[model samples]
Target chain A: MLLLAVKGITESNRKFLSQYDVTVVTPDTITAQQIPEIVISYAWDDAIGQKILANPNSKLKWIQTQSAGVDYLPLKKLKDFGVVVTNASGLKAIPIAQTVLSYILYFARGLNIYASRTHWEPYTNQYLVTELPVLVFGTGRIGQQIASHIRAFGGTVYGVNTTGHMVDGFDEVYSMHDYQKALAKSRVVVDGLPGTPETDDFFNNHFFDQVNQLFLFINIGRGTTLNQNDLLAAIDDSRVKYAALDVTTPEPLPKNHPLFDRPQVLLTQHTSWGEYVNAGRTGGLFRLFEKNVPSFVKSGTIQYNIVNLDKGY
Target chain B: MLLLAVKGITESNRKFLSQYDVTVVTPDTITAQQIPEIVISYAWDDAIGQKILANPNSKLKWIQTQSAGVDYLPLKKLKDFGVVVTNASGLKAIPIAQTVLSYILYFARGLNIYASRTHWEPYTNQYLVTELPVLVFGTGRIGQQIASHIRAFGGTVYGVNTTGHMVDGFDEVYSMHDYQKALAKSRVVVDGLPGTPETDDFFNNHFFDQVNQLFLFINIGRGTTLNQNDLLAAIDDSRVKYAALDVTTPEPLPKNHPLFDRPQVLLTQHTSWGEYVNAGRTGGLFRLFEKNVPSFVKSGTIQYNIVNLDKGY
Candidate 1:
């Protein structure tokens, strides 16, 4: 079987994957006509989607995207070819969860404010900071992990999920319908949902206006899921004290971008996932695939496969 | 039975204690001449020590100090009176352990430096930063807790104790004789030893000079146990990169002290045991005491209550 290794898998990881009976190919190294059985598309939003679609062969059994979201993938075309689509959904959960908790704690206890202001003077007033209650959207693996860590650090956690399945560590779990209730009660709101037509610009002017003005917000999932204009207005109106963004629209946000210049905004260049210690490794992915392949073959169901094309993730 | 409500134990706590067949008395409220069955002294420093000694307590059968350190309780007077001495020895273990781990991650990963620096600029330079290892002194309740938390965060943990008992979480547990060896290999050294005559100035200039120059050190134990001169020299000679002190000599470190002026130093006015969310009620110590009191009454020996008068705690 052939597998495409995109976004430059580490040399150490590549060496390990070479041991398996898999031929690693890059988009530059192959043509659409010679479609591999397992097409590992790194940039789901790029030409890779078209490339896979061009190959109308039933031989292309699986499309393993190196991302949690597949909004840009040609789902209809893949379906036509009877291609199963699996995603790197759980891979980013650890780092993203860590980043969310870091920001929540930093904002809740005013650590960033204390660190920034107390440069020349001794920290006297930093002692008066108070704790915050957090409401996290998309209580999937990433959100659940975030809730667990935040609860461990003494923050009250509430989550919103499609199914409203009660998460183990959250103080309260709510269905997606209870968004307004969650927002009303939270001092901080974290947007961790995938970008879908329904979810895009979910944090617009109306949504931000309703959220508590004292709320500190964060977005680590999809950048387009937020309305940039509403976010700026929220910041200007003091509705949102600060917003720490890991993923942003127009990636590599230009230095002069207003969001970058916003006093309360912290823009991290999509580096939340794949950090220094636990960067993406193909060997780990291959091991996951090894376990998943037999189950899929037996039951005709891909465990992490994303469906519901309209929902986009 | 008589129970002395020390350490400003609130009327609420005293009321709770009164549920048992015990009478509560404070030092200021009760005369020493009219000594109760047991005198609970919270502070064992010079000022409090002289007060206790001034009271010739002929009827005092037991002395239960709220502090873990029995150094200043006039142990000699208690010995002369044949009074059984017990202390709230493990009260601060969990909190101190939480603090130690907080500093371990903060220093090892250079979180403090990053938090202190201007993170507005993009990050460059991709070389291995530093190896993280922590050496904990006094492998007692607090030290072991620190080790457990540090190890949980993927740090290499080494410990030093009097008995050299094998601790599960630590990579290596060494006796006092092998502390130098442990220190030599550690990236950070956490002082958790109680303040005794033998431990006073325990982390001297000589000891600092023997370790790596890039090392980080912290003291969450007794402030008087450390030599300020050695700490100053360690910073001056570049033997230690930085020192995070929760406890410092002459508590509430004077405004213009050199250590306060040092940029590398992070001083937290010995407030690690502040009544924060989970900390206000660290029931571990109380639970241990409540459980062992009956056992002590039956067997004449309590677990973890070994206090040697010669070396005070």
Candidate 2:
């Protein structure tokens, strides 16, 4: 069954589900209406968590989310109701990693400036540019891929990971707790962390204070992980020159939000996942549902199921 | 030695005896003064031919140019005078090739348009882009390097050369005769041809006509290879979507040039060789001169030494 609560997927996704035996159910359709055997949850819709938690009579057996982070989903409520929770992981790894590299190259070459019609100067070509080091938080598959691509372009790649294993392309890899040292050494910071309670406010004023001038910051993973106050303070202090965020807290971030009008801040409407337009993979949610239903029913445990209680994505 | 000439090196080129021993001289610098032992001519300078043809100096033993193209340097005049001409060939291959790939990515991913602060709109995170088919006009060292770098970034590379030999990273290789067909099929074109009478207007209106609307043209070789009138016509016809030029006739193309006003064109003041500003290499001319002079004096021939007076580099 298709779920409307998912933030990034909607009417277009429902059309794709029609190809299968799935039917879309919006918040209106799900209430005072017939219930389906399964209900999918989009990571961005936490309010639906309360609705699903309040109605145990519908007998929901499976809960699938369209986002990689399942922390926001009411995993405890789903678990109490014996509902299985799974996420749309691995799907965003490549695209998100590619987007990270795009930011790196954009900052390194000053390409955005060069490509602009206004900055198009003729004699200014004789000027030189200094290269800055990039420090990436998290060295998972997406982070490794980002590091490799950045290194290919003659960039020094540094990363922070739980294991701190010696990765191939990273000039230096550090433990997660050692991020402070990495920040001091880097002029560019990329946040690609999975959002959990531990991750919220990971990039705060303290983090920004360590970044050098003209420092660039980008976040593509979770909006809640960033502290709006900390980011604003950092920009005000001129410690961070610019920030390009794909994900932000309270997305469709209010018009009056500081980030929306902040100088040097490029707030994207979370397009890192939008490459699917040309990829022709918009039916991903339904496809994932179709693939997991039978297994979830037979095994009583989804193959890629996420446990909210354990907080493991 | 640095050579700064206006029109071309003159007959008095052989008169500057001590000026060039440690200093650089152009045709302009030698007019009212004595001729230096060494004269530097760049491929960008079309006036070199006139200077050499007018000078009948047998004492001029060496000529060095700041340009990679040796075609315009008076090969016959220097040969008859037993003066060897060395070129600054390999200096710009890397940066020029990098710029070429940057343009390819800019076109293929539509980054050129999206990166614009004034033109960009909020886009969904699920957008994907199709790759472009790129054609390199000259499959020499710079072309080969450009093809390699572009292919590394997941681009299809096509190359054209005199011999049509197989290149490692290119999907297709064609001779000059097949260039028209190649141009017809490719979405992007990069011309690195030398400025010879034969090559003048190589990319004329007819060529621009064959280019598709998706075409992104780049010229890093000599400006004469592209006819200004033809390029302007192509821009008007909308045959080329974006054009990035590092070299053009009339270096500092007049302020009133139509291209300066074209929105689709990005003009760089032929400074691809300014690698030193980016901490790449310093004093490329002096290094090239020092390395090739002894070899030219010993073997009486130099690599990248252009000879065909009819072709005119």
Query: Number of the top candidate by TM-score?
Result: 2
Number of clashes recorded per candidate: 0, 25
TM-score of each: 0.72, 0.78
Q: lDDT tens string, model 2, A236-304?
A: 878787787878777666656777566467665576755534343444655555566555445555676
Best candidate according to lDDT:
1
TM-score of chain A of each: 0.84, 0.76
Model 1 docking grade: incorrect
Task: Report the error of model 2 at residue A207, Å.
Answer: 1.6
The 10-residue segment of model 1 chain A with minimum total lDDT is: A121-130
lDDT per residue for candidate 2 within B59-82, as digits (tens), equals: 345556666787545566566666
